[model samples]
Target: MRPSGNAVPAARRPLAALDEPVRVEYRTVHGYRRAFLRAGSGPVLLLVHGIGDSADTWRDLIPVLARDHTVIAPDLLGHGRSDKPRADYSVAAYANAMRDLLGILDVDRVTLVGHSLGGGVAMQFAYQYPERVERLVLVSTGGVGRDVNPVLRLVSLPYMDQLMHLLRLPTTKVVGRVGAAAVRRLPLDLGYDVDDLLRIFEALPDAQSRSAVTRTLRAVVDWRGQVVTMLDRCYLARAVPTLLVWGRHDTIVPVDHAFVAHAAMPGSRLEVFEGSGHFPHHCEPARFLGVLQEFLAATQPAGHDTDAWRRLLRYGRGDGATDAGAHLADQALAQSHRTAT
Candidate 1:
């Protein structure tokens, strides 16, 4: 929504930077355009991005993990270079798109990592495709309970689709021009601050990026209160070598929410990044990658499936992630930089 006469900054913002291109494509069916970046080699790692973000959001962390993993990050159907379909915006829709993408890529088993809205999607994917997933990482995810981030409540509100359609248009340049001006007038509403929050949010308006923000929010309300409840319940039912990472200062999704997820998945370990916000990968890159690497590496397959993973899935003790580490140079190198799209 623009300001009175000119474009004024609204609550929505833009990313700090764009990412390097890898492989790009658009599926004709949903007009889903995507980019694939391959990094490192060991086990395959599939990355899911947060709402209002593309695979590029992982730019700072991908290279770190890439050293140890064949990372796959896509720009979901309607984000990045991805096509903007006239429809399909629900979280389930996002998961379905990922399922299709994975099938096309012929990925069998993967360690799935998701952030923010992406985290919720990761959990949902694990629930639906347990056999395909080797392990799980959820960063500041939802679907745990009612303690949603305040800003998220605004984005997840019902009837936001019509609102999205009306506002999401023009290219990033146009939106940026107007948004920056409006931001000058708009008071900062977000409660948390790592830096100049208003200045960062004023950057929104990149056509593809902005549209993504619009779609995810509008379509998220499409759930009708079913899937959120389902995923929350599923967390307790299935334990897939889970690793929960959260930032103490995450305003988008509070760090406290990790407690609910940790409680849900009995054996899952929660790592707290002190002073970091929603984008732990960005705010606390080194630590985030180290913890992630340690967890994934620990879950690597031995001659036999590990007891830790089995124990996590409640199938007896199984081999899996959640191992704390002091050094993860190789893993950090691959995952530290580079993003999915």
Candidate 2:
């Protein structure tokens, strides 16, 4: 499973395999079966997917990561093979689910990596239980700034769930394929993001999946733009080793947020893929793997210190909430500004 220099990610893979089998396993959480793929045996690496995606989204990077780390990719509630209950889909909920899932699996510590929506969840997970996280990797993550794609904002609208239902009609696939083909013929350079979105749309053949999708979207987004943000709390990561990865061409979530976030977290590392889009790991597997491996090797895993965390929370690093806390508060105010127009 060595990464090739010029390998383009396949649209789909039959299965992700390491030197050993990457088998899909399930854990019953809140009476729902949460499906996950686990392989290798070393430092635990938890991979979380974004909205409209599943654990399978990590297929391109899992095998390579598995070479030296235990990779755990889970299908979040309402996505993939996991049961989509009429449950809360907020970042905090997802973080708690991951915590409980790790508890069941007896995994105490991990290098947490998350993409898009998963990134927000990863941040929340680290904040809630800092002791459980060894390191942090955020790739094209949301909740940094309120600059999400317009379509995602539309999906957050109150009545869009009904519209999404209509899109699941039997003839929708035929119409989508025709539209996708037409788009391909145009001179415009729309990458695979449209195709990926269409595929995600087609996946919602049932009401449960559709409900989950809409609920999840509405939890993080609103008609105004992104309503949930982690910038306010990113100061908490000062003691943790953090890496920021983004695609310069990403339209889904602007790459500029990565720079702002990197600055916000004093010691974080930022890597930008020059010509890549939202899924940089998929588009540039070799480079992504190399960067991740190098970061993991260079940094030491973080350990929780109760006294320091308490002091930081109580007095906020000597400046009396005038430094990191001030900047974070400003970001929170900016996040509240309406950007949908």
Candidate 3:
């Protein structure tokens, strides 16, 4: 049900500064109009935003990242300026669409950066097309652990589809406003922050967006938590340079996931923002960009070796590991050197 007109919260406020003008482009993918943001030039950096979020999520970080890297941020289907369609919203499907979008744009080999739900999609992308990703960055990503915010779990219920429909009604805007106001007044610092949560509600005032959000979330989450996990398949990411970042106060996806995933992936780097919530990049942009730039500068791009990959599959470890893997190991050792010195 909707709240009164004056009860709704304000639109999501921009936390990051966008000084430079980024270009927005559109293309037809699978008969749907897809929108994306592009700027700067150098090593390709593909940024994927989470569910209920658009390319706008990257607005603050893009200006700086684009200075040295060609930044490409896409609005996943059913979010942002992109067309909302009743289609398969699984991670695999989103990955395939990303592949097609890149192919059409004539872009090759990219450093994939994904946030939240986008992080799951990024992992799926790397898994499906290993040769295309050079490095991987997951920020408050999903599909890494079983624990998630109960809000997401609640949405994945049996009658949630009907509930989502009710949320799309005219009354929802007022309810959203009231909820947002109530959440904003609470002291979220004691646990997880609900600022982003309120924004998600603000974005779902219409039927189309509401349906898209429900379908997208249900594909990866359920009443228990996350139904899809990348832990088992993390070994596949061994050849690709990986970095994990999370906020200590993240309520949606626990920060423990970053540590668990870092340990599982051998030499992957992990950085936890002590003062941030679910959206670290928004809460701590400087640190986020710094860590990203350093990782990109230090690590080598991954090049797939079919023989080595097959050997990895057969022997449970590839004797012919890529130079990228060796580079990462070297970086680890060098860090040890600095520590010793």
Candidate 4:
């Protein structure tokens, strides 16, 4: 007859609570504008968005998690709101940017949650700074393996990377808007059922609106060289309380990578969202939020916690891509904190 705490993020809490546009004027080591979004207050949870995505991608799921987490999602340098330096744009650079941001915020520890490229950064960060990460969550991540789709192979080409730079070089105004619209449209037409991409777009600042598209594409293109050190290190992926959320129909990254990551990190839990594509958090909001909350809940410490629905935090947020979307709604929580300043 009683309820749990995490329920607020699921039912009542507005996404804006977690989507509050943070405009910190933080800079990279070399001094480039880096913006990030921070919300909620509990255990520190750092969220990393995937390729072509900013913190806005986590809009649907953050409120739910932020209800119980001090959610901090950064637009990796050259992606969302971070600086787009012309220097090295490898995954290692991106990971270092994260480390710098954490240091700025004085975040010494966290349950790192990364999606796509962000996921790669998270894994690599965990490998580099094992003590800082209390837990790890990889969602449709890259850098975990070498098996990539033919389309991705083309996207990651050196020539294509140059082309991206050339395009953004002339003018990022009309070019940026056109590219942004295309990215949103094509993905929606392919798999996502959402009609209002504007809602997500609105969450971005005007400053971001100008440079986001071209910069994001370039960042995606530039972060092509893969790193296997984290993947090779079993202790990194499997060392902490790990949670992986992936979509079964994710052609962009494919669904099998989840299993591959699980295989690499034995006992690591997987959530393959059915009928969902790359942005499971958006396509299947209810289910995605449910599973994510459950996963995080399982890792939540007890005693002082008083959320009523906390008990109902069951259900692994994952389903086999081929399997029906039946195996949802069980308590599955996963493990964060640190001072960067």
Candidate of highest TM-score: 2
RMSD of 4: 11.7
- The best candidate by lDDT is 2
TM-scores for the candidates: 0.68, 0.88, 0.84, 0.66
In model 1, the runs with Cα more than 4 Å from the true position are 1-31, 155-212, 221-227, 230-232, 235-239, 301-341
| Residues 48-78, model 3: lDDT tens digits | 9998888877776788888788899999999
Query: Candidate 4, residues 1-341: lDDT per residue as tens digits?
Result: 21221121243223344443333344555567777777778788888886555775665556567666788888776565565555555566677878888898888888888877777788777756666777787877765444444444554544554454443453653565565567656644333422223233333344434344434434433243232324334332343778888878675666766765665565578888875666666666777667767777777422222232232124222222222211110100000011111
lDDT of 1 at 241: 77
Clashes of 2: 0
Model 1 lDDT per residue over 1-341, tens place: 43321111233222323243334344444444556555556678888876655666665566666655677887766665566656667677777777888787777778878887788777767656566777788888865544455454555565654544444455753675556566446554232332323333333445555555666665443222212532223432244677888878776555656765565465677998874666667666667777987887676431223453355456422222223221221232232232111
Cα lDDT, all candidates: 0.58, 0.80, 0.78, 0.57
Q: Is candidate 3 or candidate 4 better by TM-score?
A: 3
Better of 1 and 3 by lDDT: 3
Task: Identify the superior model by TM-score, candidate 1 or candidate 3.
Answer: 3
Q: What is the C-alpha RMSD of each candidate to the true structure, in Å?
A: 10.2, 4.8, 8.1, 11.7
Which segments of candidate 3 are over 4 A away from where they belong? 1-20, 165-192, 317-341
